[model samples]
Target: MANPAGEAARPTILRTPLGRVRGSGSAKSGTHHWWMQRVTSIALLPLTIWFIVALATSAGMTHAEAVAWIGHPFNAVLLLALIGLTFHHAAAGLQVVLEDYAKPEWVKITSVLAVKAVCTLLALAAALAVIRLAV
Candidate 1:
């Protein structure tokens, strides 16, 4: 059926473990997540590409040469940034996925927290390695 203004729409109900909630397209969440994902994705694009190219260029090099390549100040800084942002992005994505799909409260929370901890640790390790190499 159409409204007086001639707009027809079907309402959506959100069924969650908490309870039933109504959904609104204009609500703050969707747009916020979308923007965040896009921004991080834009960051990852150049970073991953650069890392890939760096690896490709070093493919046939000796270990010493590869170490020397990574020891450059600019390269070390970029590597650290890439590692940190990559983990942050992964944690954010997995958090959203778990929040949306996981039905059990404990499971969802544990999974999200576990992912966050592991990724954070990995990112820190990566950054430290880069810094050590640079120094």
Candidate 2:
């Protein structure tokens, strides 16, 4: 129907609930980012628990002992995984937030880039520390 301003009416969108959400991700990469976030978070659950328990068990231990604890193969491996996944998840989540909230396009792009870079650097540093101790 024509409006008071003599404008033509726009057609309503016809989409199922799922269809509406099918491509809601940034740059069509929503599914990948969403899945990775879930997987990393799930994986982190056990790793975090183990880390806490390990620390608790090692309470009052000497510096060398703590280093020794991290130096073990299994612990070192899990620690590395935790660091990598944590950073990945953080960068992904922060990018989504910045994309959604940042007003200027440049701000969103720069923020996402900065967040990812910082996360990468921190993860690498943590992994290196773990490797040094393990070695």
Candidate 3:
């Protein structure tokens, strides 16, 4: 039906009593998570390219030569950034997937927390390794 102003009336969504009690609900953090995912993805592009080029250029290097390449200040910093962002992106993606598909609430929460912890530890280890190499 058209309203007095001639715009069609919008249909209203019918909710169950329980749903009505719950109201329009959300954790209110989806936007932040989405933005972080996008920002990390953009940051990874250049870092990944740098890694590929560096790897290709160092293809035939001996252990010492490779170590020297990584030990360069710029390379070390970029590598650390790459490692950190890669792990963070993985964790965020995994979290979304688990939240969407995991059936039990406790399972979903536990899986997300486990992913976060593992990613954090891996990133820390990679960063430490890079720092040791640089030093």
What are the lDDT figures for the candidates, one per model?
Answer: 0.83, 0.89, 0.91
TM-score rank, highest first? 3, 2, 1
lDDT string for model 1 (1-135, tens) is: 898998887777555534434442444575786687788899999999999998877679887886787789888888887997788789899999999998799999999999999999989888887787789
Highest lDDT model number: 3
Model 1, backbone clash pairs (residues 3+ apart or across chains), number: 0
* C-alpha lDDT (0 to 100) for residue 36 of candidate 2: 90
Runs in model 3 with CA error above 4 Å?
A: 1-30
Q: Please list the residue runs of candidate 2 whose C-alpha ends up more than 4 Å from where it truly belongs after superposition.
A: 1-28
Worst 10 residues of 3 by lDDT: 21-30
**Whole-structure CA lDDT of model 3:** 0.91
> Residue 14 CA error for candidate 3 (Å)?
14
Q: Which whole-number lDDT from 0 to 100 does residue 60 have in model 2?
A: 94
lDDT of 1 at 54: 81
lDDT of 3 by residue, 62-123 (tens): 98988888799999999999999999999999999999999799999999999999999999
- Model 1, C-alpha of 56: deviation from truth (Å): 1.8
Clashing pairs in 3: none
> In model 2, how large is the Cα lDDT of residue 123?
97
- Cα miss at 107, model 1 (Å)? 0.2
